[model samples]
Target: MAFLELKNIYKSYFLGKEEFPVLKGINLDFELGDFVSILGESGGGKSTLMNIIGGLDRAFSGEVLLAGQKLNHSKEASLNKYRRETIGYIYQSYNLIPHLNVLDNVALALDMTTLTASERKKRALDLLEQVGLQDHVKKYPKQLSGGQKQRVAIARALASDPQVIIADEPTGALDSQNTEEVLALLNKIAAEGRLVITVTHSQHVADSGTRIVRLADGKIISDQRLKPAYNAKVESKLQSRKLPLVTSMRNAFKHFKYHFKRNLLIIIGTAVGLFSVITFNGLGTGVKGYVNEQINSLVNPKQVLVTPYVKSSNNNQRSSYVNLTAGDKTVNTFSNKDIAALKQVKNVTKVEKIHTLSNVATSFNKKSTNITTVTNWTSVLNASSIKKGRLPKTGEIVIDKKNIAKSLTNNPNSLIGKTITLTYTGLNKSGQKATITIKVKVVGLTESSGSSQINAIGGNTIENALKAANMSTDVAALGVSASSMNTAKKVAKNINKLKVSGKLRFTATAVSSMLDRIETYISLITNVLAGIAGISLLVSALMIIVTMYMSVSDRTKEIGILRALGESKRDIRRLFTSESILLGIFSATFATIIALAVQSLANSALSQIAHYSFIQISLSNIISAFIISIVISLLAAILPARHAASLNPIDALAGE
Candidate 1:
């Protein structure tokens, strides 16, 4: 049985409906160790026959039996496997990948196998050494001369240890000296017990082989035996292995590094979108924090404010005028029952029944003035807020320093121990109206803001004054203080939900809740801004797609070389997709680092005025940015990757 048998092969081409026959019933037999040269002129079917024999063109009616096994032309997988394991093609153009060095280009064929990375590299180097181009293994195709490039191509073809080498016009572009060198290499390859089939138009080239088969007008015209086949000195054997995913990723990375400057610009464009999203989110966080700090400074976080739930019917000015008249039992107020109920709320450390007087007349040594409002002390004021004296005791008051200086005395500190007269109309316990007068000593002076006045009397002092003035000491609302801010918020939520006598009697309020609402609004606005910025990311994704498509176009021949080396379509897709993912990762990381640096710089500049570090970026936000960027980039690469994978190997090699 022949080593390779082409039994009655027939092939043709069609332009629309017109047929052009290329091969006409050609039958050939080739054995191991035979160097057969198919010599023919232009327009003959020598190349077409070579394409079929090399497993490149399977669209033909034929029995391609290798060692008695018929090649199945209808099954693409079978053709690929046969091509990968049995045949090596040497093209006239050399067809080396421009981006890859000589060593990596040679290693391309071995990547389809299970060999370790180091082993594949070692074997490729060994092949280069055998071709006498060992020192040029690290040089790219453009860096090498025509002779050296052809030698590298020969080394690549032999990297997988195929049994048959099909050379199509192998020496067509070579000078006489290089042609002799390549012919000597082919003769050596045939002597190693493998078939060497060369297709050429030169009779001089055909004479170097052991046999010459001449074709004319798509038919074999003559066959001549030049010499007996050489005996094998050593027969090469293949230890086939499967390609690892890492190999493809490494190859993809090399392509990226080859065009690092161009790819860096795309990555930076993508990073701009990521930076905007991350920075805006961080700014929202910082603004909320600043607002919360201001709120916490004004009002105690541990204090929950309580107000009466005035229904619409009693919320008119008539109800307010009645309360000021001091006999307003009709005003909705919390009774002892309500106060007791509030005291039982969870996390309530203490509950104080607060009282207030509006439009109160006060006299300091006959310097009389009507105070707009007066409040009794509660847990809301911290001790540090009192600038001069301590908190008010019974029958004592604490007024703002500015109020004392403006209203009663020129020296505010000197009035801290002086007596002041307060007169107001109120309601007694019996719900009757009367006038009240009380003399209280000032015990503290607080730092006042420009917006409001501050005058706080002791809770007991205000209650006693109201009691003696025939005014009902009915409490306005219960002031509840919790153990912590978080506990206060939780307690406030529960208290606002409480109903007394089947009607909601009180509403709970906290500084934290107001800050939370502000934070929520800020977040919504930030997200809107970030979303607008995200539109630029779509443009960046388009850039990536365009870049990848350009890469596919630029590396069309490289893609062809890989496919010809037995790379599946899936492998080709992975190669392009991996580059996209790498771009995403690089851009995301770069953007995150830039965002952090900006946050640090901005925080430093703002803290000098605000007295706090306000900018913050959370770990989850950083991770989310990375994931979103990568997902978008990978999605953009799908079309280009698929297009690259679907390129025809023959046509791709023929492209520039």
Candidate 2:
């Protein structure tokens, strides 16, 4: 049986909706160790015949058998395996991988083989030696002569120890001497008990083959055998070929190196957008946390604040209120009746009713400091911590740590039990001064609450001193606390109702609403800033798409070559898609690092300004940014990969 056979093969194509037959019925057979050459004119479909035989094209309707197994109409995967393991192909154009050195280029076929790196390297070197390219192993294709490049291509084809070697005008680009050398190599291949077939237009090449098959317009017109020509020396030389294994990795590394700069630029560009997104989200989280902490720090978690509402005594008076003045027509700011009513609410607990007096001054040793005074001693003292001494009694004073540290030249402990004279000037009774010579012991010293104070004075002690000095007049505001926040709020509502009924002149409801409005405005500003930052992400997506499209175009010839080397269309698509996916991964990783750096800088700046700690990035934000980047990259790569896979191999090769 013949080692290879083609029977009644026919191939056709459509030209403007008209069927154009490229190959008519054809039959051929080849035995092992046969050197056959098919000579044809241009446009005679000689290349197409070689493509069909090499499994690069399967548009023909025919039966092709190799080693007694049918090759025609087989599954694509099976054909790919056959091409990978059974046949070696040499193209006239060399088709060396531009990025790889000669040795790596030659070892490309053996990448999928079960050979070790050393084994693949050894085989590639041996093949290069056989083809007389041993000295050019480290040189890229562009640096080598046409003959040397073709020799490398031949070495590549032979890397897998294929049974049949198919040469499509293999020596067409070589000089006369180089052509002779290549032709002699092909003849030597056949002498090693392998089938060598060549498609050519050269009479010299045709005459060199043991058998000649002539094709005219895609049909075989002659099949003739020439005189036996065998070379035992060449056979022995060719059969001595051996391969090393490391060349596959070297090829992959060369490919990566060639494309590294462009890919790195793409990665960095993508990372910029991801960094913005991550940083913004991180800042939001950090700011929100800070706000919550500040609020919680100032207010007790179990406490609720309540305010009073005022109503006008007369309809005529309400009409006179054209503008909302500070002192309204009527409302009891902190009536004792309201406090009594609040004590009746459900879950009622100890409630502290206190009034504030602002801008009261205390004089000691001819130095005076301004302070705010609160009326309640027991409830206020119980809720706060005294850093030193104890809560003040009626005749004692409690000062803040700041006042002790800043004003007192003597020991704070000695000053604690010392007497200080008090003087108060009433807000209502302007220019009226009141003085009280009270022999008061200094008691507790505290850190300033909610707001800072330049001097120390306890809420209860200040109010008592004012009263003693006959400076007590109107109450500024009130503080209320209950067993729980819910109970406190209920009591507060009741107090508001009492203020409305009593028609007092002060109300606390306005202050609470003002604070709420401030919070709402801050939230609005944050959202606006976030929305603006989000626009950059969309731009990043477009950038990814453009980059991937450029990559597809740049690697078109490479994709075609892989397809011609028996890679399936799926494999071609996957290669491009994988490259894009890897780009996304790299971008996201770098972007996360950039975001963290920005966060650190932001935190440092905020700490210096606010005297507190802050964080501007969070793990969740990083995760979200990565997910968005990956999705954008995958979406961007889809169209480019499809376009790459759909490319016509013939056009791609021709363009190259």
Candidate 3:
């Protein structure tokens, strides 16, 4: 049996119902080390027969046998392996990938083999030296002469260690001198141990080979022989495999580097969108932190102020139940029973009955000030808010600077040691107003907070003063304390659910609740801003899709060359997707850099005034952005990669 044989092969093309026969019942046999030429004129089905034998066209009826084992041309995967392991093609136009250097072009086919990277490179270098293009290894196809290009093509064909070499007009585009060189190389390839087949119409080219088979009108007309075939010794061959992902990524990076100027613009455009999202998210986090800090400085974060449940006219829930004057007839004071109920709340460390008086007339050393509001001191007050002196003790009063500093004394702290007479009306336990006049020592001065109640007296002092007049000791408000800010909020939430006689009894307000509303607003704003940023990302993704499609159009011939060199459709698709993923990665990297720079600059500037970092890009944000970029780009390349993969090798090779 022949080492390679084609039996009863037939092929045709269709124009609707009409048929044009290209090959009619062809039979041939090949042995190792035979330099055979298939000679024919144009449109004589010479190329058609070559396509069938090369596994590029599987629609032909034929039995291709290698070593008595029949080849299944109809099975695509088997055909791909067959071509990769058994055949090498040298095209008339050279068909070298323009972007690849001579050495890389040769090594391209080796990517399909199960060769180590170092081994593939070494073999490719050895093959280039063999073809006498060692000096031009770094030169691209466009930089080489016709002869150099053909030599590169020869080296690439032999790189995969194929058993048979098929030269489709190997010397058709070369000068006479170059033609002689290329033909000599093909002859040497056959002489070594491989079957070398050349297709040509020139009789001179045909006579150069060891054997010639003439074809006309799709039929073999004559056969001639110039010499006997050489005997080849058995040797190891390169095994074939699918293109590896790392190799695909490397190729993608090469292409990405090749067109850096164009791709840089894409990266910047995509980065802008990602930058916007990162900035907004970071800004939201910072804004929330700043607001929480400011409010925390004014009140104790772990303390909640509870008041009678007073629903506003718009039904907005009231924040506090503190009353400053006996004129506030609307509020029901907290009895010992009510305070006990609040103490039962979970997570509550302790609870204190809160009392306050409004319109308190104070006379201190002949200088009188009408204190607009006064409340019993509790943990609900932030100690930092005390601008001077300490918190009020049992017999001491802390007066706010609002009225006391200007109207009562030159220095507010000076009044801290003075004895002040306080005259005010308080509600008795029966809910009737009673007049009270008392002397209290001023121990502390507080900042002029714009709240309704700013003056604070010790809780015991106020309760004792009320009892001295036989007035109501019952308090209008309660202050509940918890371990932490989070726990305080939880306790407040539970406090709102507290019921007296099955009726909602109290309304609780914690500084954290205000922070919650602030954060919610910031989050909603951030998400809106991020969504707006996503629109740009969508545009960037579309840009990637369009770019990949244009690449498919531009590299059509390169795709064909790879297919002819034994690459499967899956390999071709992965090649394009790999490039897209690279684009995505580069874009995300650029975005992260841009976001970080802006974060630093913005925080530096904003911190001078706000004393806070207003932009905080997290590591997770950067990572998530990269993942999003890669995923979007990969999805964008799907249709284009599939389109490139589906291209017919014959048609693509013939593409301009």
Provide the TM-score for each candidate, comma-separated.
Answer: 0.83, 0.76, 0.88
Candidates sorted by TM-score, best first = 3, 1, 2
* Candidate 3: segments with Cα more than 4 A from true spot: 311-329, 356-375, 382-475, 483-490, 501-503
Candidate 1 local lDDT, 497-521, one digit each (tens): 7878886767777767777788889
Q: After best superposition, candidate 1 residue 485: deviation in angstroms?
A: 6.3
Per-residue CA lDDT of model 2 for 32-118, tens digit only, reads 788899899988988888877877777789888987889754587777676767678888998777877888778777765767669
Residue pairs with backbone overlap in model 1: 113-241, 113-242, 114-241, 114-242, 427-471, 427-472, 428-470, 428-471, 428-472
Candidate 3: count of backbone clashes, pairs at least 3 residues apart or interchain: 4
Question: lDDT tens digits, residues 1-656, model 3?
Answer: 69888999999999999999989999999888899999989999999998888889989887888889998877899989888898999989999998788889999999989899899999999999998888888888889999899999999999888889999999999999999999999888987889999999889999988899999999999888889987874343778898788888888888888889988988998999988988898888888887776666567889998888865556675545444454666677777788888888888888987776778898877888788777788888778767778878887787777667567877766676888898997667677878888788887777632353357887488878888888767666788998788798888888998898897779888878887888999999999999999999999999999999999999999999989988889989999999999889999999999899999998899777766798988888888899989999999999999999999999999998
Give the lDDT ranking, best first. 3, 1, 2
Q: Specify the highest-TM-score model's number.
A: 3
Candidate 1 C-alpha RMSD relative to the actual structure: 5.3
**Who is ahead in TM-score, 1 or 3?**
3
Which candidate, 2 or 3, would have the higher TM-score against the true structure?
3
lDDT of 3 at 643: 100
